[model samples]
Target chain A: MEEVHGRHSSGWFDVCQHRRMSNTRSLPLLAPESDAAAGPCCPPLTERPFTAEEAETAARMFKALGDPVRLRLFSAVASHEGGEACVCDISDVGVSQPTVSHHLKKLKEAGLLTSERRGTWVYYRVEPSVLSAMGKLLTVAPAVL
Target chain B: MEEVHGRHSSGWFDVCQHRRMSNTRSLPLLAPESDAAAGPCCPPLTERPFTAEEAETAARMFKALGDPVRLRLFSAVASHEGGEACVCDISDVGVSQPTVSHHLKKLKEAGLLTSERRGTWVYYRVEPSVLSAMGKLLTVAPAVL
Candidate 1:
């Protein structure tokens, strides 16, 4: 039951959530251009209700971080010595290599993490812009205007 | 297929994700005690890697917001007048009342929103402490400490 549940949850995370935000070009953010280019960006959600497109895009990233394993993997990478980690370095997450890779792919696709091949392993780093944006979007902050 | 995808995703959101954070007392945050009591709380995720328990609790709330429709509903209710709204007011989400209620229950159960019954309908309001804690938890802000 746990295995089936894991498979289905990860599948949904990949298909429904990840696919929805596949086109970073179309993601609805406060500063789409800068955000896409990895610049500082994040419009406050308190300003107004999110449009249909924005909600879908933001929800995908949140969904990507929705699993405990993925959250731990992400945190392990984000909090690594240099703000990134190679597959070998994050091996302590207790999951198999394939599962780790799968979560990495989902995180990258959701824009929360970016990965690049380095030697024989893939290194992953948190996409600060996207992570910041997601946090800011969900923030129901005090009215400071 | 879309329906199946939606059902599966929402089901996973409800099952594994929701159930993990069902206990508010165990939620990870700067001030778990205060936050659980509806007081000010939430440290910062960037401060440290969340413990296994913290990761599980936090992921549940994030997963609840993974759906577009739920996001829309949450945003509408959050942005509604007085920082609260009834089922009738959030009708703009386009789903039926039951769907909205279900999502609201998920949000409420995750500690993001609180509710009270008044007259013919239930009124929902953002739990500032919980919402703030979630935002602070996810925020990878500049190290001010």
Candidate 2:
């Protein structure tokens, strides 16, 4: 396991170097512009009762973070340096690599994460706005002005 | 269904009046002081990776809000006119009364809410600090000062 982790870690560094040399533009799996255009998906729960559709959308995101392993993997990525992480760096959450990959896929599907495959490994990032959006969803509106 | 909702709504009003007249102190199921004493349970995920214990605790709260019905019910209580809501006022989320109670119980168990019994109704409050704590948990630290 250590050997595999080392190899992947080195592979990631190589990809970074390659990208710098070639000046290849990073292609995000989900367009950040689209997420911004979508706007805050729901008002703060303290602002008003969620519409059924809004509740469903918000619930999906929370559900994705409901498991300990998934939440750990997500935290590992979110807290990693540069607001992103290589799968190689974050697959150490006491789970098998396959399980780690599975959780990453679930997070991606739930729109909580965006990923790109640079070389042999995948890089994951929490969109800058996603966490703030979630915080806003649960925020207690400030005394209604 | 409408009739039942009306009855409950009136019951809540009655309870409110009784509390006002009798000068009864609200008895919160969980003391707000204890939550404050515990401090923020975990640093923002963006601040650092969570320990297994921290992730476990946080995941339980997220899991409790993971379901659509529970999320809706929580929103109902959270977004009600005041910081707190009577169960009677927020039980119209297209589920049976028992199911609504079940979801509310789950939320309380997760430490997301506190409740008090008054007359015929149970009043639920979002515990001002809990929402802020959750918001803080997801907040991206402000560019590390």
Per-residue lDDT tens digits of candidate 1, residues A9-34?
33333233222222222212233343
Per-residue accuracy of model 2 over A1-145 as CA lDDT, tens digit each: 3354432544454454443333223323224467631347888888888888888988888899899999998898787766577876677788877888999999988878889887665678876566777888877676542
Chain A accuracy of model 1 expressed as TM-score: 0.67
Per-prediction TM-score:
0.71, 0.79
Provide the global lDDT of candidate 2 against the true structure: 0.73
The runs of at least 3 residues in candidate 2 whose Cα sits more than 4 Å from the true structure, single-residue gaps closed, are: A1-32, A36-38, B1-39
- Backbone clash numbers for all candidates listed: 1, 0
- Name the top TM-score candidate: 2
lDDT of 1 by residue, B3-62 (tens): 533323333322332232223342233454534433333346556566677678778877
Per residue, candidate 2 scores C-alpha lDDT tens digits across B1-145 of: 2353354533446456455334234434234575532236778987888889888988888898899888888888777655567776777778899999999998888878888787666778776566677788888676542
Error of 2 at A67 (Å): 1.3
- List, for all models, the DockQ compared with the true complex: 0.29, 0.56
